[model samples]
Target: MSEELDIPEEGTESLYERRAFVIDKGQEPLRIDKYIQMHLEGSTRNKVQNGIDAGFVTVNGKTVKSNYKVKPGDEIILLSLVNPEHTVLKRENIPLDIVYEDDTVMVINKPANMVVHPGVGNFSGTLLNGVAYYLEKQNPGLDEDSLPRFGLVHRIDKNTTGLIVLAKTADAAAHLAKQFFHHDVKRKYTALVWGDMEQDEGTVTGHIARHRQYRKMFDVYPDGETGKHAITHYRTLERFHYVSLVECVLETGRTHQIRVHMKHIGHTLFNDWEYGGDRILKGTIYTKYKQFVDNCFELCPRCALHAQTLGFIHPVTKKEMLFESPLPADMAMVIVKWRNYIANRKEL
Candidate 1:
């Protein structure tokens, strides 16, 4: 028997597929939770238990408890959430800058302006859509329901360009998710922020939460009154007197952590329109200088941030893995412009 139930947003992970099974005629009794875990590659007993408690798992079309003992020829059905199957997922033929790929994981150098997944205003042309197409090629003749869903451990902003790792299998996704949750993964971002830094290095700690009024933006709640704990450690990479390029290491991953933390310290990312870095926040207001700044803005129109490096212990190898991507053309050009502007001013 098959049933499509209303998807509950909370208390459930994103589901990839629904599965049904029947106990062997001669099989002995086994706990439903353990039985499900044994059959599912990436699912744990706890996850199955959660499903059971939430009434996501049923026996003979009736919701059952985790400890329910299965009898011979008993019918079982599980509603697993997290990954949407291929039929519902939009597949695009977009090119992917694959950094590395194997049976377990894939790392891609995502470009600026590409959404990681589909949502609200972004219905297509996302990185995941492209990934679906790629995965379809790798696993041909597979049923649509059996196709692997996109396994994302973490995500960068829409405009933040650089390396993002994806799991190819259920086991890999579970392991990678654990690493991210425990803060075992190392993530580094390079950002060009407005204003000269008085200190060479510093750390920003605060609670980050959604803005009370602006639902689309995030803010740092300094009083620990709201939001999740976030930490960002930053060191000045190069200073251009008016603006500086900084490398930021994230201790905690929260929505807009780096962006909000930097802004909290009074150094907003350059060209970050949402955080008010798009205007002339530094340097002389002369016409020539204004034109120069405007030109730099045009050169790198998006937020001046890049996920430069990522390091983590490989789930399969138990060995360290590190990946890096150079600054894209837009960011590189703006950096050069800043360097020349600083040098020429010093010569005068």
Candidate 2:
């Protein structure tokens, strides 16, 4: 997403416009809601104020109050439901592996190859579609509009499998969103990466932003010149010569944080096609080694990353809640193959 504002041309009416603005260096501090009303056409102070109250407006990805002062270079994003670009969420009968559910929240063990929400190319058959269907079935009179992003507080990549939490009500959504925005949620992931880590454990710190050339990919900016600050702590679990199983704990949640951070430190996740981990980055070039890697790739065709653990304070209960999921079949099988290969080679 660009840090530039999407101001419509003069006299144009865009009631549902999704607006983004990067405050200029010379910008003076102004109340966020007032600033928005001044810049947004066909908008009232009441509407902007209401949007801020409803968490529809964010400053640097964190929800803020109407009175919050917009500082220089602050990235402000405002979303409106009336926008034509926003898709009407469809309720589909897609299957969901729901791990836990209550009146306030729902935790799901998302499968690989499943998009979290409907988008341009994937307008249906997403996790949100199935969640809509399930929520409606559970409560026949449930209002979909009351829930933002279909109750999604956070999301993993499409090919990244594992635990995700969803809010069931507006109040719950607000509470969960606040927690995530403040980085209060505890998230841990298991990743298979190329090469043996130089240290048993270390931290990767950098700013993450969309690549200048590759729009679909993100890159690390250590100079603090661009991107949002992100931090990831990782520790090796087991080393398999050419690959290592590792656990990652995130302090800040940014797009592709773990994947990009791991790659930045020269240990890209195994078979992470987006970050150039699909081919052999380490180990011998023997034909036998190539064949073994090919078989492993066939076993796990997607990125070797899994969100294994999630922890947060329950919106309603106000108590700490934690959940864990085992690795999916494909990843587990590939790990087992690496283990067996190491053992057989040792015997030989």
Candidate 3:
């Protein structure tokens, strides 16, 4: 019998096709590639061998050769970019804000309200579809199979605007994936939280997991509890009495790490719909105060979070690469309003 391990979400780990299996006690010894081909439906021998060559298949948490023999009770794990579902991709000419691109990689400044990948309620019109169309235009006969997951190495939330990197080749994807898995990539986000932070800078360390009651939301767990370890270091940039603008640097990227960590400390991100930031969590209940808060929300309707900076080593060139994006107009305008509000309040 075999069991599949839970795949980590896009932001937490490399969003690859992952499958885990444990060999049955009664099973006879078989070649690793052949065993994988037998267990993974629709997988061909050639494909399995290629995956093995690319260090996608591992036994007992270690990469192995295709000829390695699998024994009973052996744990086998496969991580590939190729999705077994083979979902047909529809290329749409969606406009993309390309920050930088080269032979092996590309950087994009993703806007708010755009889902990064196609899923449940969002099937088409994702960043991936747009990337597919863009890649097709760049290389007329591009074989997507060679560029798994459109070379997406990491992900940001749908409402978060900022820089995301993409690889163009299998080798590049593998290299970049390794970097993300090791937490070597530099990611910095700008967030406006509900309340003023007492400290200028500090780190929030906790284990993060999906909420028990609300499956869509995540909560921070105590250490050694039911979740992956996450760390976020934040520095206050500008403080508005009702809210504070902070720069968050991710030490470990778990799903909703920044949002959850901020909320854990009594300062949920402003306008974060999923975490109750959309409501007026801070500030007075006075009509005038409420109106000002509502106006700020209207200026930036979605989560007031931006993935402002991303830095990584070039997969092929092995050179350090860093990119920065200014806060989106909506978020910037909201900050301006808050600045004005504080200025006016001081005058009074």
Clash-forming residue pairs, model 3: none
Q: Write one digit per residue (lDDT tens) for candidate 2, span 1-348.
A: 124664431111111235688988878889999898887666667656766887778899999999999988899977653322233678888889999999899999999999877777888888988998888888886654544342776788999999999888656766776677567888999999999888999999888888999999999986659877788999999998889999999988877889999999999999999999999999887899899999999999999999999999998889999999999999999999998898888543
| The candidate that achieves the highest TM-score relative to the unseen native structure | 3
Task: Give the residue spans of candidate 1 off by over 4 A.
Answer: 1-87, 141-150, 346-348
| lDDT minimum window of 10 residues, candidate 1 | 7-16
Q: lDDT (0-100) at residue 58 of candidate 2? A: 84
Task: Give lDDT for model 1.
Answer: 0.78
lDDT of each: 0.78, 0.81, 0.83
lDDT of 3 by residue, 1-348 (tens): 556677653347357645678887888888999888877777678767867876667799888989999898888877665333445666788999999999899999999999777666776888888998999888998765544443677778889999999888766776787777677999999999998899999999998999999999999988887888788999999999889999999988887899999999999999998999998987776799889888988889999999999999998789999999998999999999999888888443
Backbone steric clashes in candidate 2, count: 1
Supply every candidate's count of residue pairs whose N, Cα or C atoms clash at under 3 angstroms.
6, 1, 0
Error of 1 at 297 (Å): 1.0
Q: What TM-score, computed on C-alpha atoms, does each candidate reach?
A: 0.77, 0.80, 0.88
Model 3 is weakest, by summed lDDT over 10 consecutive residues, at 80-89
Better of 1 and 2 by lDDT: 2
Model 2 — which ten-residue stretch has the worst lDDT? 8-17
